[model samples]
Target chain A: MAEARRRILVVEDEYIIAVDLADALAESGIEVVGPVGNVARALAVIEAEPLDGAILDINLAGDAVYPVADALRARFIPFVFATGYDRSAIASGYETVPRCEKPVDGKRVADLLFRSIADR
Target chain B: MADDSPAAAPSPGSDELLRVVIESATDFAIFSMDPSGLVTGWNTGAERLLGYSETEMLGRSADAIFTPEDRVAGKAEEERRVATAEGRAIDERWQMRKNGDRFWASGLMMPLSAPGLGYVKILRDRTEQHHTEMRIRESEARFRLLATNIPQLVFRAQADGRRSWGSPQWIDFTGLSFEDSMGFGWLDAIHPEDRDATLAAWNDAAEIGEYYVEHRVRRATTGEYRWHQTRARPIQTGTDDRDVDWVGTMTDVHDLRELQGRQQILMAELQHRTRNLLAVTQAIAARTLRASASLDAFSTEFAGRLRALSRVQGLLARTDQGAIGLRELVWGEMEMHGDIEGRVTITGPTVTLTPTTAQTIGLALHELATNALKHGALAHDEGRLGIGWDVAATRPGYALVLDWCESGVALPHGRPRHAGYGSELIERALPYQLGAMTRLDFTADGVRCRITIPLRSANHG
Candidate 1:
């Protein structure tokens, strides 16, 4: 039997972006987890689910996703941010993490997250 | 002392008519004195005006009516000596009455015969008029003190824009002298653009009884135009309402306008909204590409979605409350296709959504209705579509519960859940953006979606 595929969580507040991103990840032969939309739900999923990596949109609706980003960091999981905001919006501790500015493509987000995980 | 009786008006028997006229001339105190300045003659007018009768005044010195200070200063003797040489000496001064009350007396003395001789005199009391003039002088001094010391620039003007005077504060603030500020010269210190409006307000003051205007006035030190509020009120002159004069003041309000500060903030906000909108357009195009079978199909679907986005942006732009109503969002998408007068029913308790939430939900609604028109309930005449929403309590807070259902249609086989854009937005976007709880059921009859989204004014992160 083949080894289990990596389960990557997609945390994006925009529905179309999340669906497209989630579909793109699935097309690449990886097991995709939730594309949770809010900070609280994303935190819950991060706490309970088994994940290889995650992608985040810095703003979920109007609330910043820093708390969710903090949770992923606490668990030692690697993730990349997709944001309409500039790089300065991210917390200083997570400054070194990759950022893919919106109008962002899924492949770039995936590559950045997996690369971040491998480096760690 | 009794040399000449010519100072008396006349004997009663010789000029009875003249004597009666003199006696009854109650406004004047007609009396005479001999060359020695003693009281030699008296009349009833003198008695009434001076509070003295002929019996009490006879043989008394004419100087008896002089005030103590005037007598001490020899004013009575000097007047008599001047009258002897000049034919008449006129003086108005404080004189005493018999009861010790003081009256302001206007008196004239001339020589009874020649210089260094006794003199005749005439007197009139003007005490009430003098008191009134003194009161006016005192109030004017008090007003001058207040106007100069206040921080605001004060002025006196006619109903026209012509100013009669400006306070010391006005002169100091505008660097304009009393000469330069007179008439319409004060307009030179106001901003050119604001002068016309200020003058117009001033012109209307006659009918309105007041002048009020907000304009820019130049500060003399900095030579900069600053915002100032000027107000003037008419002071009516008693019964006739004529002889009106205006009292006005100008107060600086430069900091309150804050025009530049607000413009900078709006610039930043505009940039942010623009960037976010572009990102949204990119997302729509990408998804439309995924769901289409051909380039032509992609173009049509993508265009429709873009129009939906534009409509929502239009709604967002016009909303003064920074929110869009739920009913507007739904009908906005539905009406874009055509009127859903009979085919679709929408009911909801009015609720508002934030810009971010409205944008996301608007896309979801577009896809839902579009899908129905193309392949679902809206495609069949027998099908029915119902949309309803109401507020309900949830764990964290209250939320808007919305139901979208289509009946009298069969779910097409081989169409997998979450395989298309409509289902994706409904199932994923709503939950992501609003923390919404949603359910989409593809049953034996038709498609149904229920969503619960929390209600709150949006907060910008």
Candidate 2:
């Protein structure tokens, strides 16, 4: 039996940021599941698809992605939050989640996500 | 030897000396009244002090010299009766002058040992002294009132920096009684961390007759140490060593200090946000260049993206509350392309976006609309586009699902083989940024897209 490609869901709202992140993930030889624009699609994909891990934008089209974060947490799926804001903007319970500030390097984010999942 | 006879009285030369001495007296109004209280004699002193000469007053009733109220109350008659019974009477009361002005008179009535003459009256003016005393009392009362009622913590200290007085406000603010704050005891109300510095400043100020310092004082009500600016100036005495006292006030400045601190933090945050925006702009330019085949194409696309960003910024600025409505964001992009009234049909309840979300979504909408105008259904006059969104009934929380459809135009053969930034934005960026599951399909008829993403929370618009 052959192992499946590791599919990572990408949750971001900005077009440019999402494209850059997807390109970085593709360059890393990782199968990208989504470049979702909001929390609804992110959670839907998370439930319908078998995710290896996830890359999340802390805010989604004017909405906070905490619901998606909480869902990923419930599933024991490791993820990294990509944000334009600082760490203080993150709620208390999600402190341990890794944060990557804006103008994010996709390769760095991918590495962090993989490492976090591996650690898990 | 008994000297009871008139022939035994005084010699003619001695009588002349007596008249000259009495007339020369300017302070006392030497005048004599008969048994009936009639003016019998008046001297130059009487004329100067009462504004009346002997010619005008000698035959007048002496009762005219008393104030009307005193005369009405029988004070003049009472004085005569007292003088006749006791052989003398003295009083300090208001006496009328010839000009109708009143003077405080120190007067005496005495009986003379002469036949048919009852008494002689002596009057002196004391008006200036009485007015001076009253003025001093009024000034003292005003000072007492201001010291007690003012809001600032007022204080008075001796030349040597020994505090002599503190306003009631000090007691109210620091819960220290006047007795406790007097002298050096008031130092205890100051913050312990500020005590040494305050004392040093106080000593310095004592020499210069100016006291000014800012330090913390413990507030009694909250037991919190709050900042206060204290200032005092020397009560200037004419002589250098006679600088007798310092009056000072302490004003609360803790709120202003805290506001200044907050302003610094906000400034830093603004700097950070500006840096992030610049980086994002750089990335947009780089990606647009890579995705374009020619400089003109790159310029046009880049300019369009920048405009998209600026439009969102304008909207955010106008709203001022930091949240932008999703309907407004979508309409803004479509409207910029030209008249969107008939061609674009949008349906959604209401959705307000955060600053980050609105900007990102606004750019995505711009890219979508631009592509439609260039190669999609919107390129044709009869073509139509419909956009709508709704919250998905998802477990744990609601999610957003949006649909875009176009009609009245022939579609392409199939989905484009190479994914450009716009396609990538729709297919990959949506999922990455918003965790959205999106589908972009090009059919023989038109292009359609469906996006489903999780809402932030159930209550959010």
Candidate 3:
């Protein structure tokens, strides 16, 4: 059986970081979705697209991305958190989601995204 | 007409009676002066006070006893003119005596006119009373100086709350002049928020004739409000059944009040830090104890871990309570093994780790790096380790990925039958505290451990 190409969404505010992550994922042969930087655009992409999984930045322009986390949860799309802050700074409800700290390795990005999609 | 009057009776007995009366008086100086202002009669009072006997003064001109300046200014002529025109003249002035010394005197000159003779004048002296009045005036001047120089805003007010006298100190302290500090002007200097209560307190005290004390005033320099204690009380008896004057003072106590506020905040911060430290220590102890087989083993392991913690804490203290750079902390832990010159390569952009995160990660990294040095890859000089991390994009969170990769060490025969303290702590304890997913891989060539800590638990330094 041929390996299925996983669809992943990247939500990051910083322009360079978002581009780096998308390029890294695409190089790993995974299909990259919208690398949206704001909450409204991220939510619209999630609703319009067929996303298998996602990577989310904890802060977007000084506001939290919990609403995106909530929408992903409702859609049963597994997502991982990427942050510079420690775990204590995250809200209590989202504690169980997988998290990766920067600077992320290209291979680990492939592995974690593949695992999150396969688990879903 | 002269023979009909008692003065012209020419009785030797009447003359003796008059002499007896004049000589016996102590408080009054009775003397007679002729129309030319000469001393024609003198009594015992004049003899004792003026230091002149009645016989010596009887023929002398009264002008001889006046001060040189008063004589030059025609004071004697002025007195005589008033006496002749107004029948009697009263003057309070400096007078000279037989010794040419001056005394403040209240003198009265009365003109005595008979039917056929020239006018006779009666003079009375008042030097003693004048001295008492001078002393009283001096005392009042001293009191005024004291009130003006006090550090507080000293003031005097009438019974109706009208300010009568405000000290110069008020101008010095409030930068307001005497006129500006009176009545409602004083209330204007008070902070608007505190003005009503301060006025009410003053009014109540004034109505009941009690001491008024209030703490509400504005600072002179900044126009910022400050606490002041203003106190006032009636200067005289309140029960005198008359209008009373009140004397008061105001003192600045803002510094004392501010010190008390700072002390309270410091006390609260101390309490919070104590509780947080206790919680962190308890967590460390519980995790260490649970991972040990025996108390002896636990003690040794815990001691080593605490020593590592203390080393990191010392480094942080040197930085003056600021975040320690991640690269520095990692390099510091590795250098403790004595020789890591070519074996370990740490790379990353400068990331500042919070103190709590630094200690946790410092200990975790210390244990892993120690294990690798002792048995895994870094034990061999040919081995190389790459330690690096960067931020990743994840929804509503950040991912920090740290890698420990080793090369050129001989492979372990198989994964160890039992996981050791270092393995369990890196895989379990760190994830629990840091909310990161940790992975440990044992390969034929070297060991690799990766930790992805969430930003929430790991961002602050």
Candidate 4:
């Protein structure tokens, strides 16, 4: 039997960017979970989904994405930050987390996510 | 040599030596006054100091040398009484000379019990020393006046930033008493986070000769913390560094610092927004290109979408707080297509939106109006478009419910372009971007779309 497609979740607020990111992830033959726009929905996905990594935007609407990040960390689910903020603005313990800074393409996001999560 | 003890009676040779010493002392006028205050003996020093020879001043009242004010105040008699009772009396006053000039005189009077020696007086001119003391008194009074009245909180500290004194303003602002503010007690009034840095600045001040730090200080009345610029400088007690005392002020700079901080935040926000806008614009272009049939179609669609995005960016930029009204967004979007003076009706309460909500929603309104102009109501002169919005109460808070109605036009006879970019934005992007609930209906007469944006979404900064 063919193995299940690798699943990845996207948490971004902007509409066009989210669609573009979702399309890019889908094109890579990866089963994309969501481009959930806020922290609450992102956390729901983290709790329900299994078996892969995630891409997170540092700012979800007006809320920090750290709670989602903390959830991901507690589950040992690997993730990378796609953010507009610099390292200093990120919460501590997340400064060292790999980041694909804002205005980056989906391929860069996907590649960084896979590289960080390949072992798991 | 054998009679060298000071308490012993003077030898004959020593008494002669004392007479010579007394007569030659030009600064001290040694003289004897009789019981009636008459001058009975005088020396050369007396003639030099008082500008009088023995012949001129002999038998004259010693009161003649006292200033008129001092004599009128009975200072001469008071000196005599004090000397008789106390064995020695010291008096300092402005005395008159034979030429009518004046000098400050510090005098000592002693009563001698030996015969013919009623009182012995020694006088020394101390005019320069008296002038110096007077100058110091006047300067000290001026310093007190300035320090107390100035708006800044004045303080005096040692070289190591130990508080020696604080002005009344300190007590009034920090609620710290004079005693409580002594030593490290004043540090309690400083914000704990700022104290370490403030102390560091003071520690450096000893070598740098100045102390300067900005910190939060607690206000006694409101118990609020306000930013204060604390500064001090060594008072320069001497050449030695350890003898230094510092005088400084703590000036309230909360408002000024807050303004500067807000300006910096605005600058950073502008930079972040510019970058985010560029990202959104890129996505719009990419999506438009994928939906277009050819390069020409892509150019037309992409340009329209960019214009919509740029217009909202303009609206957002002009506003200090990015507050875009619902009516203004709809009216401006409709007006961009053509003359919307009477053809469009927009009604709404004062509904404000954040920049992100306005940007995507502005584009959605642009697309709806564009479609109406191309195929719906505005395509015919008989067409009418009505747009209205109101903030309706929702479960948690309130949500803005906007209605767009296009009437007096026959519906498209063929299938609806459900897969197009405009439909995708209205049906999908609105919900994802603003967390809005939207319904687009293909009614027989025209198209009616209702967009409900929950105010609880990411619309706030």
Give me the displacement of residue A88 in model 4, in angstroms. 6.3
True-vs-predicted CA distance for residue B202, candidate 1, Å: 49
- Compare the candidates by DockQ and give the number of the best one: 4
DockQ score of each predicted structure, in the order shown = 0.25, 0.19, 0.02, 0.57
Each candidate's fnat, in order? Answer: 0.47, 0.37, 0.00, 0.57
TM-score-based ranking: 4, 2, 3, 1
True contacts kept of 2: 0.37
State residue A104's C-alpha deviation in candidate 4, in Å.
4.5
lDDT of 3 by residue, B1-461 (tens): 76699987766788798788878875566677777777888778877667778888887877766789999999987887787788788888887778987776677876777522223433456566665556656755776888877777787876545677778777766777788877767666777787667667767886677656556676688787778877788764232447467877788888888897787655644443343334344445555686788999789777777767777777777886557778888888888777787777888766777665677788878787777877877788888888998777577677777888877878776676777666766775565445568998877778888888777545633
**TM-score, one value per model:** 0.48, 0.57, 0.56, 0.76
lDDT of 1 by residue, B75-157 (tens): 88888778876789998889998888899888887776644446667888878767766765676677788888888899999
For candidate 2, report its TM-score.
Answer: 0.57
* Docking category of candidate 1: acceptable
Residue B167 alpha-carbon offset, candidate 1, angstroms = 23
Candidate 2 ranges beyond 4 A from true positions: A1-120, B1-145, B158-162, B193-197, B200-213, B237-244, B258-271, B458-461
| Top candidate by lDDT | 4
Judging by lDDT, tell me the better candidate of 1 and 4. Answer: 4
Candidate 4 displacement at residue B388 in angstroms: 5.2
